[model samples]
Target: MLAGKRILLIIGGGIAAFKTPELIRALRGAGAAVTPVLTRAGAEFVTPLTISSLAGEVAHGDLFDLTHEAEIGHIQLSRAADLVVVVPATADLMAKMAQGLANDLASTLLLATDKRVLIAPAMNVRMWEHAATQRNIATLKSDGVLFAGPTDGDMACGEFGPGRMVEPLEIKSAIEAALSDGPLKGRHILVTSGPTHEPIDPVRYIANRSSGAQGTALAEALRDLGARVSFITGPASVPPPAGVTVTRVETAREMQAAVQAALPADAAIFAAAVADWRVENAASKKMKKDGSGALPTLAFAENPDILAQVSQMTSGRPALVVGFAAETHDVQRHATEKRARKGCDWIVANDVSPETGIMGGSENAVTVIDDKGAEQWDRMSKADTARRLAARIAAALGAS
Candidate 1:
């Protein structure tokens, strides 16, 4: 889908640079021509020769190379590609880019270029969330720059939290989505993802096995289409997408409240695996295991039905309301019934049986049910599912 498109890749100094080789493969597979640019500090993490080998072109460096100037000079390099991508965008590189400092070849190329820029940041979690870094991120967003991921996880530094670079496949999907036609521009979207943990006690809670990958990916895809997104997310394993307003919640109640406040959105995708029931009477203190040698009977109460309420809203109602149905049996039957019961426009159903393992795994097999009927998609990776779903949403929004 990205044939004839050119991507200028700027590698930065960070541990995440190791993923660049796979990124090159994915980009090439998508039919985008890749050109490599290495910063002086970037070379410390990955060699120019490795970049040159994968990109199948001489790596570009130096502000005054006679050969580069003979053809693709700094001016040409900046203006040549359809998009400029920074993998492992380190703290130092981001600082320079945000400030428009051109002290190195990579920064020079970026400053001189006018292409759409995408940065996949990777760093120590502390560095990523530092006030200075956060401020720089805000500056970049206001400047209309794009960002893919700084997904949360155990970092190479042994600390766990946000600030890991998005996987190469994730970055590739973002580029493809960006290059696709912008039919969904000016549309407003609402997406919910991750698992909501409903507290029963100080140390325990009710939760699900959602990683929030699918919903987060959907948010990125929608953003690439020029849609404004209000991403209300539950406590997720991944950091929220950059450039999107993220409302983080820990329970179904919080998620519901956040979603309602973000109303009048053009479309709503209820992808979060919200807990169905919460402890009716949560203990103020940790419940002691009594000598009775009996387990505590936890009373459960239904949480707010976020999807149904939004679907049935009267004031500032969204044009589209999409809900999710996770079924272990009768996937089609349950999904069809859910569409009607929830009063949603559609239901994306999946089997979450332990044997299927689709709940927490990266791959997904979903059957979309609407008034017309059901369409079962072949099992695919969640990232691919996100792209396809994004395209479908774009097409539907254009029709409306």
Candidate 2:
């Protein structure tokens, strides 16, 4: 996906800095020409020679290498790449970036760059979660700087939280998403993911088996195509993808409101397994399981149909409205009916019977139903399915 792209990788000071060599290799394998800029603190964790060797190019370090400056000015270096990537972006570096500090070579380049910046933050758990750091992160996000992850896991420090840098492969995926000249560029796409949790009580809720894997993949695929994605997700098992605006919701009502709020989008893909009903008269506090002879009876109320509502919009409706139908029997029939019932432009139907293992699994076999007819797609990885769907969406929108 990154073929012929030029990436400026800024390595910052952190134990995670040691992982940049692998990142460099991954980028190169994807055909991205990498230019390494090793920070002074980054040099402590990994040698400039190793970074340069792995990237197959000389690493830039000094802020004012007279000879280097003469050859390629700092401004030119900053603007030369398709994208700027900061791996192991330390808390200090993040602070500097947020504060517009440019004291060294790395900071100077970042400040001078006109290109989009993607940062993979890596720091101690406390440092990553600190209020100041959180504020700085918010500031940077508001400024339109992209971010991959400081995924939750074991960190170099003894304690663990959401500070560990994501693996090279994930970073590679992010880089691809960041740099791809996808057909959906400049388009705004709204995607809903995961199973909505309809609250039964303060402590418990009604939920589904959806892991959100498919929806996350679809959102990522759309984003890779350069769409400005508004990812409205439930409490999903998989983390949300990078390079998109993510809004997390828990219940069907909240999800509906969020979807409505992300209005005037070019397209809307409703992939969430939203609960059809919610418990009426839900308990404000945890209901005690008192040893009464009889069990408590629960009343049900219908939840807002987000997909139907969006599809049947009279004003400011999206150009494309897509819905998903997960059925156990007669998938095609049900999906075809659903497309008409919901007034959506298209319907993606898949068997989610427990026996099929497609509900929470990594692969999907689906038939996309549109006004023209049903297009049966063979079983494939969810990522591939999403990519295909995104392509179709791009083409359909282009034609429209």
Number of the top-ranking candidate, with lDDT as the measure: 2
lDDT (C-alpha) at residue 6 in model 1: 96
Q: Write model 2 residue lDDT over 1-400, tens digit each, in one string.
A: 7888999999998899888988888889888899999999999999999988889888998988998788666788899999999998999999999999999999999999999898898888898879999889878866767777767788766888778888878888777777767788768889999999988788899999999999999999898888878788898899988767666789999999888877879999999999999999898988787877677779999999889999998999999999999999999999999999999999999999998899999999999999999999999999999999999999999997
Give residue 400's error in model 2 in angstroms.
3.6
The residue-by-residue lDDT of candidate 1 on 1-400, one tens digit each, is 6788999999998989989999998888778899999887788888999999999888887878988777758889889898898997899988988999988789888788877788888999999889999888877755656677777789998999889787888788667755655777657789999999998899888888888988988888887777767788888887677645566789999998888766768999999998889999998899897798999888889999988899998788788889989899999998998899989998999999999988888899999998899999999998889889988888888888
TM-score list, all predictions:
0.66, 0.78
- What are the Cα lDDT values of the candidates? 0.85, 0.89
Backbone clash pairs for candidate 1 read none
Candidate 2: C-alpha RMSD to true structure equals 4.0
**TM value for model 1:** 0.66
Which candidate achieves the best TM-score against the true structure?
Answer: 2
